[model samples]
Every structure is written in C-alpha cells, then in structure tokens.
Target chain A: MLNAQVEPYQRLRENLSQRDRSLREKVMTLEEAASFVQDGMKVGIGGSTMSRTPMAMIWELVRQRRKNLSCSRAITSTDGDILFGSGVSDHIITSWFAQGILWGLSKVMRRHVEQGLARYEEWSHMAVGMRFRAGGMGVPFLPIRSMLGSDVMDQRPEAKQIDCPFTGEKLLLVPALNPDVALIHVQRCDAYGNAQIDGLQFMDIDLALAANRVILTTERIVSNDQIRRAPDQTKIPFFCVDAVVEVPYGSAPHECFGIYEPMLNHMEAYVAKVNSDPVEGMREYLERYFYEPKSWNEYLALIGMEEVLDASQKGRSIYND
Target chain B: MTDTTRYTAAEILAILSARQLKDGQVVFAGVGTPLLAATLAQRLRCPGLTILFEGGVVGAFVEPGKLPPSTNDQRCTKRANMVLGSADVLLLLQRGYVDIGFMGGAQIDQFGNLNSSFIGDPAAPKTRLPGTGGGNDISSLTNMIVAMKHEKRRFVEKVDFITSPGFIRGGTSRAESGLPAGGMFRVITELAIFGFDEKTRRMKVLALNPGVSRENVQDNTGFDLVFDEQIAITEPPTEHELETLRSIDPERMFI
Candidate 1:
C-alpha cells in the first residue's frame, strides 16, 4: 500500500534549504503524533524497560486523554504504568513489567490487574521479541523453545505448541503482532528520522518495522551530516519513520543510556505519590506536570535543567571515551 | 554500625545461595534476591562468575555500591561482555549455554515447581503477579537453584501456578515432556539447602542452617521432606563473606 505515494499527511521538517521529496516528509509536533492515536487503537511502544522509553509521547497521550489504547511492548516500566494509571490504556500485551529505578512491582499496574480494571497477556521477553520479529518479517508465526512445559503456554492465548516441521521437536509458536502505530524514543535522530540508539537496541528496530506507522520521539534532533558521519550508529532508517518529534530528556526518570542516569529521586517520588491516595495523587501529578506544561521545555525547566545537565555530564563521563 | 559477627536471616539466605555458585559458571539471574545472591557470589567466592540478566545483558561485572534496579538497568550492561536483544540471551539459555539459573519465587512446591505467575486462579484472579519473563526457559534449560526464605506460606505442596518448569510429576516426567536435557534442580532457603532426589525428583534436605534445627525445617515445609542421614549443619557466614555481602547491599533492600 506504500506505493511511490507521497500523501499530504507527510510533512517534511521545516526550515531545511534542500527540499528533497525523498527526504522524510513526516516531522510533526508531539501533539500531532498523539492525535493520530484514536480510541481503541493498538499502539506498540519501543524501549527496554524504563530506559529510552517514549515518556514524552506517553505524557502527551495522557494529556490528550486518549482512551481505550491497547499498549504493546516487551518490557514496560513507567511508560506503561503512567498510561494505565491515567486510565488511557485498557489492555496491555507485554512480557514483564519493569518497575521504576527501584525494582519491584509497579503498584499501579498491580492494582489495575488485580482489581480487573485492566487486562494483560503475558509472554516471555524473547517470545514477544520473536513475535515482533515475525511481524517485521511478514511471517505468520515464529518458532521458539520458550514457555514449553510451563504455564505460560497455557496462560498466553497467542502462544501455541507445534512440532517443528524439520525435526519434529516440540516448539512454541508465537503469532506475529502488527501494531497500528509504534511510539519509539531514541537517543538521537536527524530531522529526517535516521535514528541512533545507544546501549541496548532492545526490540526497537523490529517494532518500528512491524508497525503500520512509526512515531519517533528523539532525545535531540541533529544535522543530517552528523547522522552520515556515523551511519553504523543508525538503527531505524528514514522510510520506516512516519513522524519525528524532538523531545529532550524524553525518557526522563528512565535513562537514555549514553545520555543520562535515571532520575531515581523522581521515580521514588512517583512511588510515594501513588502510595498515598492512588486516584487523587495521580490526577494532581498529571495536572502538575503534563497539563501545566505547554511544551517539553517547560517540563524540563520544572524538573530542573541543571539536574539534567549534571546527569548528562555524569553519563557522558563513562561513555565519552 | 556494621556487625561483623552476626547476620540477618535474609543475609544468611543470600550467603547460602552465593555459596552454591561455581567460579567459572554462567548464571541466569532473576531480579531481587537472586540478583543480590549472584552479586554476592561474584564479589566473594566466585570471582569469575558471569551474570546474565533477562534483558539480554551477558557477562555483566556487577560492581559494588549501586544495586541494579532491574534486569534492564543500564548498569547490567556496564563494563564487560556484549549487549544483545532480549531474545538472543534467552536463546542462549535454550541452547544450554548457561550453567546455573538462579531464581526466587513467591511460592515453591516439594517437586521444585515454582509459582511467580499468579496467586489465585488464572481466570478472574485474586492476585495477579507479573508473568514469567524468562523464568520458564531458564529453569527448563539450566541447572536451577532456587533461593528464598524458609516459610510455611511460601513453601507448599503444590504451587498455585507453575511459572517455571521443574520435574513435572517426578521420575522421568521432565524428559518425557520433551524438555531438553541438562540441568538438575536444587533448593536453597534460609533454613536449609535441599537437592532433588535423582530418581523420584523429590526435594531432600542436604544441610540445615545453623540455629535452625531439623524440626524447624520440617515445621516450615508444607510437604514431607526426605532428610539425608548425614545431613550437615550449614556453615554460618564468615566475617569476610558477611562483610562483603553487606557491603554489596548496604541498603539491605533485597537482602
């Protein structure tokens, strides 16, 4: 369906002198990215646990009060928890819940699941990755050796046990998952969306390709020359990205690897807030941070850019060499 | 003040768990107490131990002072080895590349079956726990060592759900179920160390922790235990092991 068609929805980055039609034509504001998300849409999010999560887009979705989203990711932390807490997401398909900087259950997610406010389908981390891989490869299913002889096979409806065609060995088959839209945050990206992911790539590439649309939220927007300087660092190409939004400290409270350490104090405060009056505290938190800030710059300013600078400097110390 | 002489029950459990690790073996560790025990092993006795986090971090050299918040923590990939996607690391476990799979569970049965999935029925559950990440794959493929405190509530006749694959119904059932060969199951708790019988696959007590009598282990266990005739008293943590373990987790969050 993606023929040589250049739809009007494809808006190129503004202020660029050389206007190559082939140059990525989908650079939008975060609001525009979240607007594409309709009620009851299955949205795939890419990140490894808390690190490099698309917290900016997640907050934007929460701010817009998008409802009935089916959140899909392999390792979800604060991003998923916030979506569930804000009552924006009703269903989650994930392998595991990576709690905030302190490793434990996300109390919000736990309460939702236990209280039947939300539902979940569990998979092994690998199983979900394989599902994304199969989706990207345009395959029906991927064979794996996980969840065999365990209750995960019985628990997850999408997981099936089938004998290998070649060896007749029993292997678990995970069905392909194609998300309507993928919200991914990366370390750096050009205006055209040549993204670079530092540290662990996780399943970002697979999720990006598997989704019908990719909404790339980047930590910073760099020059095309910088992207070309290190082509090997690029994980997602321009064609795979449908929209690009520049969100500095986009994965706050969760580190962006070579950029910053996770803000543990912020995470602890979030836990404390949820612990004391889960409903009112969450609403106040959303109002104070997400609704109050007109722009990401305002949010960063409230969080103290000095701390961000310090964290960025600290993280750069070990990786800058 | 750091006490050099005595250690807490959790510290004692961690020390016992750490002692099970070999020097040069690769271990697949889950989060929380399992991570704590593996870190303690790396620091104290088994310096060459390579830790594998479920987030695809391999051969992580866990340094002291900062406890990794989760398996996906960037610290998990610090300093050494390769960072792979989550699928590739679990693939290694399936290939039998890992030696030991260290795990902790909410509930464990006499047959070594673990439950971290849910506390009640799957349909309309009472308590829904986070489902298995790679726990089942690790347990099925590697030599499984369980680390937890000895409590009547945690140890049961049968788990609410078997999140990790153990010897299914005893004798030859795991192999019969098409699970790949390699890896036996062992249980390491605060009060005792137990290993499954070769034939029956039933948990048998090998040693009891100091100050914990034979009756204490029996009282805490939900199922009947088979005690070895020459069951030895588990050695208390040395001054150095205790100091190093406490130093590793000075906050005592997991310990």
Candidate 2:
C-alpha cells in the first residue's frame, strides 16, 4: 500500500524553499552548479532546437566527464549532438534532433544512434510538453490525441491507448516525465534566481516545475530590484532554483533570444567536419572545443569576438523598439 | 550566380506548394521546404495567409533575404506577432484552429503514411532521422499538404515507418479512428500534383508538370499510381514567382 503522508509530489513540494528562500542569493560558480548533475541522472534541458540552448553548462558537464545521463528537451539541436558525442548522456528523449532544416540531419547523431552507441526515445512534440505538464501537476499520465494511429505510438510503450470515458473517443495517454535536474538559460535573472525568458518559452516552465532540482544559467545576474520592477516577467522563481550562475553568452553558437543569433559560420564548420568523419571528427571537435579549452571564456575566444558581435547585432536588431 | 529565369527542383516544389494555399488559412509549417513554401505563399500569392511554426511563433512576417535556418530561429519571428508557449500553439490543433500541416518526410506510401524516423529496420537502421517534431500532431489534427521531390525511392508502396498517419487503411478510417479535424489533403511534387481518393485513400495524379509524361510519373514512382479521369497540365512557374523566390534566398541556401 502507498503511504498517504509520503507522496512523491508532497515530498517534492516540501523541498521547494519557503518565503525567506527567495531573499537569499543563490549565485554559484558554473562548476558548482553543474556538479549537481550526477552520473545516470535524468536531466532536463531548456530551450528549443538551435535557440536558447544551455550549451555552456552542457560543455561543463562534458568537461567533467559526467556520463550515462538521460536527457530530455522539447526539441534538440547541436547540443544533443555534443551530449552524445562527449558520452555525457547515453539516453536522450525528445521530439526532434536535427541540427537545422537547411543543414538537414546531424551526422554525429546518425553515427551514434545507427551504430547502437546511444539510446533515443522519440515522442511527438505536443506529447512531450503534455507529459511534462502531467509531471508538474503530479499526475501519473495525461491523455492526448497525438500519435493515435501512427507507428510512433507503437515505439513508445509508455504511451497507452484509451477510450475517453466522457466521450467514448480514442486517445493516447503519455506518462509524466520528471527529470532529476533541469539546466536552463535566460536572458537575465537576479542572484536570487528570479529568471525571465525573452523568447518563446518552449516547455521550460513545465520542465522547471516537474524537475526535482533547477540549475539556472543566466546571461547576467541582475539586481533583485531590477527583477522586482518587472515582477510579471519572472518565469522561474527563486523557490524552485537551487543554483544560479552568470554565464554571459551561455547559449552561444546556439541563438540566445534578444542577445545573439546563431553563429552560422561556426555551425557550418562543425557540421562540415562532423559530416566528413562522424567518429574521429567528433572526437577532434570535443578535444578542440570541450576538452582543450581551459574555460568557457577560452572557448569564446576561439570562436572569435567578430562572429559574436555580428550575431549580436543581428539578433538584437530583430527586436524593434 | 543567381538564376531568376530558370527554376531549380526545390524552387518548383516551393512554388507548387505555395499555390495550394488559400488567402487566409493558418498553416502549421515544418522546417526546410515546408517553411520556404509557406513563406513564398505569404509573399507572392496569399498575403493574408498566417504561417505558424511548431516552435510557437504565430502571425509573424518573414523578412526578405533573411530566411530562418530553422523554424525556431529569430528570423521566423521578425514582424508583429504574438508568441505563445509551444504547447499553446499545438493545442490549437485540437481546437481546429490550424488549417494546413505543411511538411516533407524521408518516405511516403500510397496511403499517405510518412516515415521521418529511420530508413531501414527498427532494430538496426541505415540512416537515423530526427524523430517527429510536430509531424504527427500536425497530420493527426489538420489537413496536410506533403511536399517532396518525385523519386522512386521516396514514393514507396509502403513506408518504412509511419511517423505520421494519414488514412490508416483507407475510406472513413481516419474519421473512425477518433481524429476530430482532418486528413491528408494534397501531395505536391516536382513533377506532379496528387490527391487522396475519398473512397479508396489511394494516391492519384491530378496534374503533371510541364514536359513530364505519364510514363515519367509511372516509371519514377515505386508503386502503381491511380490517374484521375481528367489529368491536367501544370503551368510552369512564372518569371515573377521565380524571381521573388530567388530574391528570398539570394545565396540559394534553400532554393
């Protein structure tokens, strides 16, 4: 029999800090925040494909050689490739994983998945969000119409077919996906972890509430007064976040909304190299980008400031006053 | 050099897909050709058409000479629009708010089933595709316009996997399956335009492009295709359509 007093959700709620917690500064180093991710944990990544990806933290995990992690995102991009390539994550659950539309598929992913080096658990885009919603709400599962008759339903045993009790219509039920930790990047947030996301919040809100712990990486740690001035904008509260690290351009290479766009030249270079030789090329990329670089700043230096400046101008220009 | 008079294979596909859209229909566009085709529709023909990205961008005007590399890119959200959560936009499909699901897949069958997951066997596949993003949800809840090149290897008797379901086993099956909104409406290709027969759910050629013979259509397709009683000739892309499409992509990144 299940214990009524010790429900998993009740326990999780208790872990979420009380009133004074929001007042306390949650700032920490990137290394310290990333250390919360242990081997073989189910981690949630914020942002959609090629936009607002928490790449710096992922690189940190790779540098730390964190292995066997099961990661999930609403949609994935080169970050997923880095996770698989670095062996930081063995299992990746998501809706999609292409680098981009024009570039087509990721050769790094193709080589690893086809060769049986990693595990890929696929779900429809809506289904992934609804599953996270179910987790956040502390429900066992949520019913939706996605993958009703498609082979995608057959691939996922977790999703069940059920006749709607009210309307007698067929529906598919997807189970809750509660990750152990969530890595998110925002445009700006206070040291107290009052974070605000600028662009389309692709499922980060659901992921934040569902995950047991949240590691927030921000472009800059603004003052609490600044966050309070725009109280309505704070999407991630300090009560849910355990660590906050200010890593400017945290989502570099990948586009960071209101900050910079995708560094196409760098991405093209990466794609070309990886396509030429998936295995050896991937290893070299890791060594050059992840391993050899002493710090995140050094990696930025390698990418060159000119590319960053150009991307910044273009990305910021997209937003008209 | 940029060629405006001559259209490439991708250009023609974009043009045909654009022509299929009406004036003010909200389209759920996927990445690559679908996005380009939908944007071309908004620009050249239907200015009132609303292009929706799976990443939750709605009603944004794509700027000239700056096509987004992906659906979620900043370029996809250039003009005035409301940006909601990704879940918020896809949930509209359940409410019958979206009109078209424009996308392309790795393989498609006579029944309109799509395979975007893998090429070979499930256990051991030759090529591993990016799993269905909003492919299934889009096709399941709204009318789909599948655009792809006509090739024997692509148009198969049966898909390797059904990443998105169309008509299941034919007549009335999609409706019977409890999907409230829509089904496969049209299939656009470089060589011809086809539609699913209401009774049989089989892919049938409605029109052939200029210089494309019936034999060319049959020989290029993997399976036997049904020909409509009145097969029409598809008009070639006009100079304006070709020029505008080229201007959209001066570098020919996608054209």
Candidate 3:
C-alpha cells in the first residue's frame, strides 16, 4: 500500500538543493586555501603532460619551503615531472617522468632518480585503471590486467600478478588510491566550487570525484545563479567540491589559453639551464620566482607582468598565431 | 679493417636515413633510436611524415640540432600540429592511425618477445629497468613494428619477460586476436637488419654490417641463428646524413 499522493524519494531530491547551497559559500584565494593541506596527507593533482596544473600553488608551496611536509602519497594522471624535479614530491604514483622527454633525461628529474632523492611507483596506464575504478566504486582496491611481462612489474614486485582462480589468467592486484585532498585548476568555477573545464578534460572529473576533499582553483569566479542557469556545463558539481579559489591567470608560464599565453622562449631558456646544471639552476629559479617573493603579488612582480605578456605574445606567434 | 671494427653511431644513423617513408604516415618515436629515426625521416625521407610522441604531441617538428632532452619538452607544444591527451593517444593507436612503431629492448627471444623490465629474477629483480611504457599498444596496433637495439649479451635467446607481444606462441594466436594482422616486420640492429618470415614471424638475417660475421651475430643473440642466401652489408652513410645526425644529437653518442 503505497500512498498514492505521497512521494517516497522526496528526500533524495531535497538533499540535492542543500548540497548545492553548501557549494556556493566556500571560496578563497589559492595561497590562502592551500594551507588546508596538512602534514601527512595524501594529495592528488589534476593535469596531463603540461596542461592545466595548479602551477601558481605549486610555486607557492616551494616558496614556503614546505619541505618534507609529511605528505606520504602523491598521485596524478601524468607525471608532473617538473614538480618532482623541483624536489617538492617524495613518493609518486605515475607511468613516466620527464622534463622535455620521457623519464627526465633532461637532468631535472634524472638527477633526482640518479641521486635517489625521491621514491616512485612506476606502473603502466593500468594503474590509472585502478585509481579511476576506485574513485567510481568508492572502493579501495581493484584487480587489473597483468603488466608483469613489462619492466614495471619487475621494478615494483609488490605489484605482482597472481593466478585468478576463475580464469587462471594472471591478474595484477592494485591498491585503490583515494586521495585525502585533490587540487584542481580549471577555466572557470563559481564561488561554491562548481567547476567548468573546457578542453581535454584530462582525468579531472575522476580525480575530483575520488578525493575526500576537493579544492578548485579557477581562472574566473562567476555568480551562483550564472552557474545554475546552465547546470549541465558544470563538470564538477557542488556536492563533490569542498572549497573554491579564484586565481586569475593561474597557469602562467605554462599557458591557460585565453587567460595567458605560453612563454616558449623563456621556457626554452629555463629548460636549457635546468638540463645543464640542475641543482644550481633550480635554486636560482626558486630564489627568483618563489622564495624571494613575500606574497603572490611580489612573485608576480619578480617576473614582471609585461615580460610574461611579451613572452606569451611571442609564443602565440610561434605556436598559435 | 681496424677502423671498421665497430659500426660507429654515425653508420647506424646513416642506415636509418636510407629507409623510405611516405607523407602522412604516422611514426611512433620511442626514446632513443626511434627518436633518431624520426629526425632522420624528417631530414631525408619524408619531411611531412607525422611524428607522434607517446607523450601525446602529434606532428612535432624538432629543429635539427635542438633535440629536446625529454618527450615532455614544452617545445613539443610549440612545434606540434596537435596536442592530444595520453588516453587519446592510446585511442589513436587502437584506431590504426599509427603506421610504424619504433621500440628498443635489452633482451629478445627467438620468438621476438622483448624484455626491458629486469635482468635477473621476476620476483626479485636484481637490476630494475625502464619497463614498456606504451610499446605494448604500439606493437599491437602499428602497421609495422620496427625494433632497434644494439647487439649485446644481455639481449639473448629467451627474454626474462615479454614486455610487448611480438610473435606470441607462433603467429596463429596473435592473428586470432585481430591485431594489425601482419607478422612482426623488421628488426634493425647496429650490426645488421633482420626480417621475419611472413608466415612464422621467425627471425631471418637479411643484411650484415660491413666486416661483421654471422658467428658474431649468433653469439650475441640468445636464439638459434637463421641466415638468408644473400646477406648484404648495409650501405655506408653519405657525408650529409652523418653530418645531420651528428649535428642533431651529438650527446647521445654515449648511449
């Protein structure tokens, strides 16, 4: 006897509105908000190759000397090799690491690997399978195809292949990686952390959904009603996001399309310097870009806006223009 | 003869340059020799042959002497026709967009199964190495799979592990899997070039480096040696090819 007029699933629909309300209130600056990442936490970052990384926050963390800050596990879809090469990361879970090529033969990441400064878990793309599956299922581990035939399995013996009783085919068992926090940079986000990622949404949705807490750093922050007007455009809804930060031109030096152009010539010079004398060059880069600056404004001042813009224009001429 | 005892890196570069390529053909460039092949293909054979990097840049144009240190070089973005995501690259590979795939290995068995994962034991690897990145997918899908490796003891009869499916358990099962449908195509070494039998996909010596003997080639490989009726020496590099290769990547001589 179902009550004809009574709605049984009213609570579920009502809960959606409340969740949306919570998302509209929490917003801050990237520097002000990243402090939420406490010591001994596992953090996931969103980007692929060199696109869409929270470069500003990464530089800020380096500037703060957030050394050995107690983060045990670091995960990303692509190896943010430059971040690792800069000495901020300790343990990494990724397929490959490189500066200009694969595996950081450019000396930035090579020096770290050669010197044993960082520990890493090298897996094939199947590792992404484990993470994404865990994020979707809300589970901690999943069985995957055996990559044991490759060098990855030999390097990380713990990620071994065991015989499946049902099929007898060897399957590699991977531990699910659900990060405590995930920091994502996007094109636009509302004050409540409803984010819109325009192009090539590289693992951001999976990462946003997988993390227990989500911090979004966006180039622009729009009003709540503007987000609600086109709800489908929001790739990450308010329910999944914990905080939002407004960061104009956030992915500087690496380009964010309409926001900033890539600085190719400067990037080339940096790459050359890093490749030749990594330790000294990295120290100089940190001093010039991060440590010497007291605030984000000061850091911006160090690499003048005009110079960055000029570099961007030059890059556009070379690449896009 | 003493001067020709070892095939210099320049000779290897020249041999690669002589290979023919067509426009719009997609070539998957791996880290070392493949990189050289791509650069050579650009310089001599087919300037418009689309160069695909596993890192997801397509139709990349690296300057002759300005070879990037790694695949993720920002220069790739500046020089690329399109920048794709890693997953998209995998999709492209599966879709048969790539024509040729270049790969390298430490050990290769009689069947052409490559091992780049370990030198000693499976469970407890004494010396861990860089494992197959996307070589598995590239090997399976590319129209032709070209293997390039320096001839040595470490690369022998039975590989420690099969990193990429070359000619698995003969060729019947591989064809059954609906893989590119062709057998393994070519194995290029510093000393010579080897081609697989059309049906068996078994290695058959096709050519030798100048002054290199069949015995020396057999001694270096782990499998039983097969010799062709007329094994020709590879053509020596012209002055231009040698100059281009040396000018492009002088540092890689050590590797």
Q: What local distance difference test score does each model get? A: 0.79, 0.86, 0.60
TM-score between candidate 1 chain A and the true chain A? 0.89
Q: Give the TM-score of candidate 2.
A: 0.96
Clashing pairs in 1: A11-A25
lDDT of 3 by residue, A1-321 (tens): 342211223532443345444534788766667675765556677764455667777766665455443221122311344455555676566654444333334465545544567654566653553454455455545665434344455565545466778967556666555566777788897777788765445556767776667788888888878888888778887778877877765665555543454554556667777767878887677667667777766765656778677845643443444
Better of 2 and 3 by lDDT: 2
Compared with the true structure, what per-residue lDDT tens digits does model 2 show for residues A116-186? 89988899999999988887888877889879888889998778788989989999988888888999999
TM-score (C-alpha, index-matched) for candidate 1: 0.91
User: Model 2, stretches more than 4 Å misplaced?
Assistant: A1-11, A14-22, B1-5
Q: Higher-TM-score candidate among 1 and 3?
A: 1
Write model 2 residue lDDT over B1-255, tens digit each, in one string: 113348778899889898999889999898777888888888887999898987789986888688888878778877737887787789988788998999987788998989899899887988889989999999999999999978899999988888988887677777777676788999998889999997999999999987788889999899999997789998898989888888887877777
- The number of the candidate with the highest lDDT is 2
For every model in order, the TM-score on chain A comes to: 0.89, 0.94, 0.80
RMSD per model, one decimal: 5.2, 2.7, 8.0
- The residue-by-residue lDDT of candidate 1 on A17-131, one tens digit each, is 2233367656789999887688898898888777788888988998899999988897777777788888899898887764643545667777788788888778777888888
Model 2 deviation from the true structure expressed as Cα RMSD, one decimal place: 2.7
TM-score of chain B of each: 0.95, 0.95, 0.87
Error of 2 at A151 (Å): 0.7
Best-matching candidate per TM-score:
2
